[model samples]
Target: MTDEISHPITMDKRVDLALAGAVVATGLLAIWMAHDFRIGKFPDPLTSRGVPYIAGGALVAGGALLAFRRLSGWRDLPGHLTVSEGTEDEAGHPASSLRAFAIMACAFVWAALLVPAGYLIATPLCLCGMMWAMRVRAPLRLIGFPVGFTLITWVIFAQMLNVLLPLGPLAPLARRLGLMY
Candidate 1:
């Protein structure tokens, strides 16, 4: 016989329950806030409240499923949920919480800069920063992907949807290029 230790319920397993609880709480909060939104004067099929309700409902459903799976000791949970912190990613790099923190910081900075710096300037920088934090080293991909994605989104919002986007200091250049009317 060999010496062995067994942990029927580990701290890592508890983490799933904690995360599920947080998600459920957030969803409930979102639904409550969305319920308070004033109805627009114009009668639109999809109001401002529609998207939030849908998102909140989805969150609640997903969290409930996750919690149920954990409580029932389901063996077929997703790989990411089972993988503990500091585990090696598919690329062989040890996943770092520092990288996650960096990405969050980048997102906060992007939101702070959005109105002043404009979407074109702010979004690419945020995407590049996030990619860098995730260990993307290729110069072409680092530069091209963010720029391309931003431009595509800008066209969709500004031109297709007829939604106004801040041009910031690029207002004159945009007008000259006929990007804005």
Candidate 2:
């Protein structure tokens, strides 16, 4: 019997791949711009460019993997089933490009405003806005998502990672919470 292949990517899949590539490329570009490209001699036995080089290489590899999986016959290689028509239960939903755009926009705005508003305020606001925009209508989740995410992010980055996020107006409150202890 002859085997047939079908398109592995829906419109949503294509959008996802493009977004991933854009993000990875942006990170790689940032690393390239911030550090010297030359691997100079170092007392620690590693150059300043070492970390960036590894990050850039990983970014490239990730983007290539996504692109290759989307555009090649790799989907059909090895164990695979023949193409078939969609059944009633297998109907696909329309891709929500608008939601994707909104989510990305929210993230950008959050990052841009983080230093100004502080992590405590900006993070919760961002999470709530993003969740609502993504059509999460449950009352509990609408409230819980932002609060939970903000607390977790604060604990992880501020407490554990030792990264100083802007405290803004919430500095007093955070101090009162005795987070430092």
Model 1 misplaced stretches (Cα beyond 4 Å):
1-11, 73-88, 176-178
* Residues 1-181 of candidate 2: C-alpha lDDT, one tens digit per residue: 8886564432444564686688579667857764856665656554776677677778777877776765574355343333332533334655577888998999999998888888888888888889988788998899898999889988898999988888777787878997642
Clashing pairs in 1: none
Per-model lDDT: 0.85, 0.73
Model 1 residue 121 distance off true place after TM-score fit, in angstroms: 1.2
Residue pair clashes in candidate 2: none
Q: Runs in model 2 with CA error above 4 Å?
A: 1-31, 34-48, 61-92, 160-162, 175-181
Score candidate 1 by lDDT: 0.85
Q: Please, what is the TM-score per model?
A: 0.75, 0.59
